[model samples]
Target: MLVYSDDYLEVIHRPASSSCILVTFNEMEMQANGSRFWGQRFCEKADFAALGFISRRPNWFPAASIEKAAAATAAILRQASERILYGHSQGGYAALRYRLLLNADVAIAFCPQLSIDPAAVPFDGRFTRHFAPALHADMEIMPEHAAGRAYVFYDPFHAVDRMHAEWIAEKQRETRLLPVHMTGHGTVRAFAGTARGLALIESCRADDVPGLRALARSVRTGAAMRPYQVALTAIARHPAWADRLSARFGNGFSSVERVNFLYHRANRHIRDGELATARDLLVEAMALQPNNLGPARRLQELDARIVRTSRT
Candidate 1:
């Protein structure tokens, strides 16, 4: 399911997991203004049981309003056994607020707006507006139970994120801090390009668990200069992901170079017995360059092979 406001909260269920993983998402545009537009799009990311509150805060949700929303979310998430909170931009701000209020086992925040209290607010815990998440109290974050982990991802080139990064580093917890000096905040691909989250997710698997511990050690150092390439590589390496992405985005965002890269990757998946994934990439190629018949024909060939194999 997808929770939508200005951004989308999607729960991705991988076959490797017996349960679903909820993703609380906030759109950069929506969170920029802090409005929660309700719809089915605002539904659960994964199973409501496995994943709970995905607060999508607008850019202007003050600091405390975001906290209140998150407090409500915490009540929802506690019902679930395993849960995580993730957000981008202002949404990240909300996720952090929620973590401060209810506390999640894990939170992935990207370019989160760390709020500073106005000097005139009487200094007695009454914020000028909403409840501030990162107050002086945040200086010593009292973890609820598990002593949760936070991985704050940001871009170094984006001076705004950099400034906030500097501020947050002061109140250090078990932090997975990443600075993408190359890519700015806007273009940072949370879905496909985030290495820290991927490493964490990969570690969950029993087989990759061994090497992942080492990878997890260098989590902050994994930011890529070419995030597009990183995303494509991730999709290519994972079965059916490229196809799923192609189906959703078409070739609108992908370039000619990306098309070619996907084609090669798609073919690799075909050779590796991932026909479903290969067919999806072929479809993406065909969509990107309709006049080029090679991909279309290749798709047909693959379909025919699938049919023949099924019959045999």
Candidate 2:
């Protein structure tokens, strides 16, 4: 069963019978479709022999409505084999919450935020509207009960990316943190060329992210990876260079080019689920740049949250 809305909220059902279900929130933002849009899109694309042809939209409810969006997913998965969840932005946050609802096979979030509360450390306003309620700290931050495989990707420049990265860093799982230098929040595009990493993520198996390995090797040696600015510029002209550079500089602070770096570093720690390290990094960054109230306020809020959780 699938539901529809004027916005792009939709569900495409298939009898594939894979326990793993993919639920993307406000994926492309849908337009007003008075008729069967998917069928037409499928027909047109399939006619052209386009396997990549899928529906797209440009409108959705605010991010606050993310939790409610999962209702559609929960209903569809009432009968399934295994469940793997994937989403970005509010979709990502909602997937995390919904993962708690089932024995999730894998939960993949591109760049999910922490919360929507005013007191919370925000990613950015535009992102928030799209990801609404999922980012809220009051959100259900559940322990991994399903198969427990999760991948969270973040970009420092984007607010949602920063928040998501921080959350992962503090999550304290034996997670494989993949850091892309100067990569924005949309990683599917960034990692499109990553066959090995893509295969690992899709299959829930890791052999070699030729990307991660080279970075570790360079760190083992004494090589300075490329800078984010240079990498970003090169990516616009030649995406291949970006891919090569991203693999080399997972957590090199030497290229601390923006305010977002603090969050990225903290998030890298969180990816390994070392919340303490993340917290400390947030604090130090906030102290060093007191002019920016976001980090300072967020550090205090997170510390209080940790304390409260510890007491509980």
TM-score of every candidate: 0.43, 0.48
In candidate 1, what are the lDDT values of residues 1-312, reduced to their tens digit?
Answer: 222222323222212232333436464454222223221132323212233233343332333443444444444445545556666665565555556454556666677655534442222222235444443334222233122566666766556666665555555465556654434564235234344445554443223434543553344244332444334544546635655654554444445645665677778878888899889989988887887777878899999989988999
TM-score of structure candidate 2: 0.48
Best by lDDT: 1
- Give a tens-digit lDDT track for model 2, residues 1-312: 235342434444443424444433333433324333222332233231111111234323233333344454455556645565555554555455555554466666666655444345544565434333433335534445223566666555544566656765466353344554445555433433344333435544342446453543333233232255445445345545644654565355342333355555555555555678779868767766768776777677678867887899
Candidate 1 overall lDDT versus native: 0.50
Error of 1 at 68 (Å): 5.0
